[model samples]
Target: MKECVLLVFLALCSAKPLFRPSYMTLKNMMLKDMEDEGDGDGDVDNSLFPTREPINSFFPFDLSPTCPFGCQCYSRVVHCSDLGLSSVPSNIPLDTRMVDLQNNKIKEIKENDFKGLTSLYALILNNNKLTKIHPKAFQTTKKLRRLYLSHNQLNEIPLNLPKSLAELRIHDNKVKKIQKETFKGMNALHVLEMSANPLDNNGIEPGAFEGLTVFHVRIAEAKLTSIPKELPSTLLELHLDYNKISNVELEDFKRYKDLQRLGLGNNRITDIENGSLANIPRIREIHLEHNKLKKIPSGLQELKYLQIIFLHSNSITKVGVNDFCPTVPKMKKSLYSAISLFQNPMKYWEIQPATFRCVLSRLSVQLGNFRK
Candidate 1:
């Protein structure tokens, strides 16, 4: 038994190669094992571990006006109207700036409706059957300016508006109220046309105009009872016509020192406060037509540049000619100076029309010659 044990120990020591771990052998064995596992699973889960794949960045497809039938295709006019499209095109080129998908049968706007068009500026989805604009549906277009969502079935305004908006026309929809912060971060918003839709005044917050930096802004038919804060400081024109704005505080027009024209036509404004037009130094024209004013505010002496004051169809019964004499010479100096008191019961002054025409003709010639 001792001899047999000695022979077995010698056999083990003298084996072909002692069982030892080698760095190269272990690496090769590991690679073989990985290959065997990959082959066993048919490489289905190989992507579970990360591996680099070549990315082709250039767009390979051609945009050769292959829009649907009855659609006009010019440079960027994708007039898919009346073609029965279900949604907007998702695979448009990144450089697409204009899209006119109006008058279509689109009912829903999913997330993939507008996927990659980054340079799109004008999105005209008017006259469509859009019931809902999905949240973040307008995410990729960083340069969207003018959006026409009129004549749709949208009950509320979509959130996350693009920043580059300049003109928005969403009229003739089912929007009930102007949501608070609806105009947030819209710095360059200039024209907002929300007419024909009912807007509740209580939903409009005080700082709604905080992000806009407009010079002349108009909400032609918005239901506003009072002016909000941070109105454009350099407001050259304001059109608040066809609304229920009745109150005009002294501080409303005080900050608009350089206002050139104001339109309060077709509103419920009854009384203008004292010194309301005092601080507006450059106000040249005003439209007070179709208001509820029983008496004119007592501060015409402060308007040094008053031109055309339209008081047509108001409830004033009498006139004060003394308010006219002071503002005449200033109008005579300016080319854009005139007063429209038609449809009002105010007594007319004896200013000669021929003299006014002669002055305007001479000024027109001089202005035209100066422009040349």
Candidate 2:
């Protein structure tokens, strides 16, 4: 028995980590999403969302029209990405549906840049050096839908964006303040990603998200110290991970009734006010990993549709049977799919199986090996 135990211990020490330690796995989630969407080699980015949703809205063809000098033109798409250009190429075909201008040195977008692209559906200007955009730059492209302006040097959201826009990725910029009516009349917008900016709570003006029905919004890696209350009430997914948020208050999520997926991981969150999550009765996934939480937040059992709860890499020391599931098991609407409690300080042996009675199975529950 001693010989077998020694062999097992030796085998364990030589084994590598089962999962990537810092890859942001809310079920294999974002940050990787940003890379997949940043690739320009593909004809079209299959992933529209910076997290999960795939891009299925565009289909490029082989019909070539009036192409710019050094750009690739095919179908109704113009591919000018990854070039060392300093300005928007001229004579772009009028019927171009999508323009790929990412990874360039373009510094400004003047009024005549997109002067005649009336049929333009998408414009990608990511990974550029843009600083100024004329208020009327996108005036003629009134039919534009998807816009990728991430990884730029913009100081604020561009003015006079098309009201028909659906997905807008302006993350990884130098934006600070978001004035009111910034997204006004953008009723068709559903996804908005603005992570890696220097925005804070005070910089966001009152009613900043007014007139927006955008559902998925990611403001991760920002300087925010608390949740922005002015976000759209129709939000289904809100990812604020990697911010400086220290607390989750009751009023922070009072108006978001349809919230489903929430990402608050990698913050300074020490406490989540009781019933703060109950306001959104339909919340499904909650990413609270890598925070300073001392215990499981109160009132989780009252949530009917809660499935995934990421509480790993925290200071939790205990687990109660009724803390996650209601006393009456039938009150639960959905079975817990995943419950991550790794990297905490809790004693694994002390946690009983009854604690996860609502879970799908023991394999679905990730526990044990709580390192100090």
Candidate 3:
């Protein structure tokens, strides 16, 4: 038995030692085993493992280029106003209907810049630094209705505007002249406001508004010394206030039969011809305040529909019976027409008391001071 044990020990010592790997070698082998268990395409089968999204995917940044960075998008309106934008933002959605980019520093509008935004209707760029607008800038937006470019630095009215436009407000601009073809295609326009422009009366050529059927036209504060000629007869309201017009000719508003409101306040008007307002039978309101008139304007009794007359802040000193009541007494029993005579030097004792009461009964007169 002792000899057998010695032989066994010698055999164990001589045999190659069993393959017992070191600690690092065993760890490497285990990692290799894990790699071998993965799919051959280098992608591990994470279906059983807990999945997690990348940390960067949870940010608030927009990756699509279809919308601008800071614009607020609603159903069909994109308001990028007051964003310190230097130009009209691109990538406006195709479904956008209105874009209000007002109060920006956009200097010009290049043609076809809004090409893809065909659904746009109202583009308000008011109070911008716009100096130039391509004639075809609004060509693609044919369905556009209102274009507000007021308070800009445009020297001339933009041409080739969309005919579908109903209201065009370019007030407070530097537009000096309106050519004959300035508004040729804008036939559907209803309101054309160009007030506070340095427009010369002669710059408006004959037939400048020939084909237009505009109802409300505002050309106030344009430095005009007289009424502009060839005005559209379809005008319902004509605002020519805050100008240098000193006299009103008889034929100034003869053709405007549909005119209801006429504004001539804040002007240097001192003389109004006898028949200047006789033809306008449907006249309702006339603003002649802050003028240099010495007496009541004639032909006020002809306006059967006249309701309000503003003649305050003038140099008038007397009131006549004929100035309030019509010669035929057609409007004697009608609603009293308000006549503002405040701030005048008319003394109640200077005029006949009976005549004054008669005029007051037919019209509502506002006096400065009176003593029975």
Candidate 4:
């Protein structure tokens, strides 16, 4: 009986309780098993748990019917002018025809920013803070016609411009030079305005405007001391005012026979060759205000179609008979021809009474109104 009790006590003491794992331990073991199964080199068995779909499998929500906040939209035309915006609006409709985003704070134009807008014709981004543009920014917008990028901070002309562009205005920027390929494909470009830049004569490449048939070219305040050679023959209006041009040679206006209006005001022109205006037959208006002319140019009398001549703030001391007598016949036919000689030294000089009467009467006979 003693031996049986001893054996029962030893058995009871050596026996172990049932091994039951906690809920947290069981969850950890199951996760480890799943991770090991996933890392296996063989194909995964999807019978236990189904696989989930990717996050980007669905299409984005539709936000194209309405314009961006603080913008006005009317029949596919969006106007976001002066909105204090810092970047291009993200919610602009892809089918927009015209987008006016002037007077904004936009800095850069990234690639594909204007994608999928095939009908976009006009884009106005003037008076903005644009600094850079991606190379493929306008690759999708091939139908763009008019682009206004004036009054910005662009350092050079953007490349890969659309060939369908007709009018491009990029005035008042920091463009230092125009490369030969800047407007390579721009065959339809008619009007180009690049005023108020630091462009010199060397900045333009030879045959820069070769393939182009631009009609109007304005490069005022560009620090040009001489006339740019090889100008477009189809030019009708040329504005080079507020420059450093000191003289007009005989062949300066030789190629510009179709030029109607020529602006050379506020320049340092002290002398003009007698035959400078001989080539321009259809010249109507000439602006020579605030120049250093000591006497009137002799070629002025030959311009038969001359209507208006601005010679104010010059150094003219007297009027001669030959100046007004030669052009009396031509001026008598035109009813709108006038010569402005205000704020000159002639106003303070003592003119001979006989000479003044002869010149004044002759001018009065030609022009309807004569004022000295």
Candidate 5:
């Protein structure tokens, strides 16, 4: 009886950790590891680095999203720019809103790269050597709004763009022709920039921008000799500077009746047909500097909203009094805030004071000698 009692005492001593003395079960506490930045000591006592919580080991929940390799994530924004990555990294968070991948060497975007990113909005991939993008790369990204593909080696615009895209910048590429279905369902797109391409007059097909309601369009520094008349009529601003345009015809801006700002500077424009400015009654600012015009464009006085005009660095030799101001001096909605005509061959003294009667102030006009 003494030997059996001693054996029972040893068993009870070994089983003390399984239960309390009152026959109650004890819950075990859990500790999670923390990430380090390689510095040994962070604080004075290093106690604030990681804390031990009293969370039970039974319940588990992954609170934070997994960040991709070599990328920084905060507030649902992933910044992977300038990382010299050749391809898209794996395991991007599903709740990512913006992914900045600019200044990398990524050549191609695969189909399933952005498969599960449902909440992605903006994707910046500028300054890369991208040449191709799989048609279904952005298929799963339904809520994507902005996409930047500038400074790439793309031969043409990528296909299968999302319908919710609002902004697209594909400038400085080798695109020469744009088909009619390039922006077929992009009705939400309002801003489009495709400058420094090899596009010309016949490169853009008819109805190329038919389905789009873009408000701003820029195709500067290209091979355009004449204005593209097939652009959307709802344009508010149009920029086509640094091109090879030689003249402006009457029908060049007939469709752009709602245009507010027009940029045609740094071109070879020698003349603008009479009544061409009547097409845009809402015109507020016009840029025609560095051209070859001999005189100011006609029908400027009829523009009720005309406020600024840049005609510097041209071959203009004269400035008429009725060029910008009306003869009747009627009530106008907007007056000229700035009229730049410097670097022209015309003499400032030759221009009459009545030429600037509708200007805002004496400091509104800019005049200088053309030192050829």
Candidate 6:
């Protein structure tokens, strides 16, 4: 009987462990981990979030159309323009700096469309179906600088533009022609690009830009047969690319003393005389790519300040002595002068027939000129 009592005592001692406080506490903690309570960390990682926040939302300004669904909202300036919107957003935030509404289906702009935007600087409405601009389209804001309306169905330039406007790009529109007084009063205008319009066929009369003060004018790729003689004297950069100009005289550019760059690429120019560019002394860069030419012009050697010259894809077969090295005689004065003859087949031999002639000609030059 005593032995039986001792066995019962031993059994009770072993079972006591199951009900102990430490063992129960450990078992409960293990069950919590097994139940997947986020690895016991306080923060939850959200890698599955669908969309990210906007960049302009942190700006101090109040710009906006708030963003559309699946987009984040921003403040400095909203870009809800390319959404094919028919009209401007109503609840756009104030103090906007710039608004881009390009490539949309917007048809009209009411007077109050941009009512509260006091700090708006640039407004881009290119490639839209805007047929009309309200008279007070930009009555409120005076700080607006640039306005772009290219490739639109507008019949005329906006008369609501501010005089303080510096740059205006309204090319490729339904406008027929620019009258002498169309942009005559814009004293601050500097750059104007009005190419690819069909207005020249109707007759671009003289003094079209009568009193305009633009410096850079681009009227290339408009199927022009003759250069516009009414160009401003202050015109600095002229791009007449892809035109039908086969006859370019010397005096055509004589009036533009301040002309810096001239782009006549992709034209049907077959001939260039010796003094073709003597008038424009300030010509620095000339791009005559894809033109018909047999040899380099003579007076190009006189352009003392010419820096870069591009003559790619021409019909020149051979290059003799002083073809490029002596073309610009004053190239030695400048530190750097780059001439690109890419896309041309130049067969320069290691030991050419005229190699000795070039060396002898250099030695025969006037000794006084070399010393001076």
State the lDDT of candidate 2 residue by residue for 1-372, as single tens digits.
Answer: 999999999999999878755522432454356466664544342222323332222324333346887788765678999888899998898967789999999999999999999778889999999999999999998778899999999999998899989999999999998888678888899999999999998988998888788899999999999998888899999999999999999988898989999999999999999879889889999999999999998888888899999999999988887889888746745788999999999988988778888888888789868765
* True-vs-predicted CA distance for residue 203, candidate 2, Å: 1.1
Off by over 4 Å in 3: 1-65, 330-334, 349-364, 369-372
lDDT of 1: 0.65
Taking the tens digit of each residue's C-alpha lDDT, what string does model 1 give over 31-135?
A: 576555553423332121124211111223223445545555444445566677776765454545577788888888887677776656788889988888888
lDDT of 6 by residue, 1-372 (tens): 999999999989888455555744654665565466442444332121213333333344333345443223343455776686888777655645677788889888888988877666778888888889897878876666678888888776677566656778887876666666666567777888776665553456578667777789877767676556677888889888877766577667776788889888888776775676888878877877787766655555556566666676765555556443334434442321555554555443432444223222343321111110
Model 3 per-residue lDDT tens digits across residues 1-372: 999999999999999968978855755665576566643555432221214332223334423346677887654567889998999887787746788899889999998678877667788999999999998888788678888999999999999888888899999999988888888878889999999999878878888888889999999989889987678889999999999999998888887988999999999999999988887878888999989898999987666677788998888888786675565654452333577877766775576544433333534766666222
TM-score computed on alpha carbons, candidate 6? 0.67
Q: Model 6 segments beyond 4 Å from truth?
A: 1-76, 90-94, 110-112, 115-118, 134-136, 199-203, 317-336, 342-372
How do the candidates rank by TM-score, highest first? Answer: 5, 2, 3, 4, 1, 6
What's model 1's lDDT at 26?
58
Pick the TM-score winner: 5
Global lDDT of each candidate: 0.65, 0.86, 0.79, 0.76, 0.87, 0.65
Better of 3 and 5 by lDDT: 5
TM-score of each: 0.68, 0.82, 0.78, 0.74, 0.83, 0.67
RMSD of 3: 18.1
Backbone N/Cα/C clashes per model: 1, 1, 0, 0, 0, 1
Worst 10 residues of 3 by lDDT: 47-56
All models, RMSD in angstroms: 18.0, 20.2, 18.1, 21.7, 11.8, 14.7
TM-score of 4: 0.74
Query: Which candidate's lDDT is highest?
Result: 5
Tell me the spans in candidate 1 whose CA falls farther than 4 Å from its real position.
Answer: 1-66, 82-86, 90-94, 230-234, 325-337, 347-372
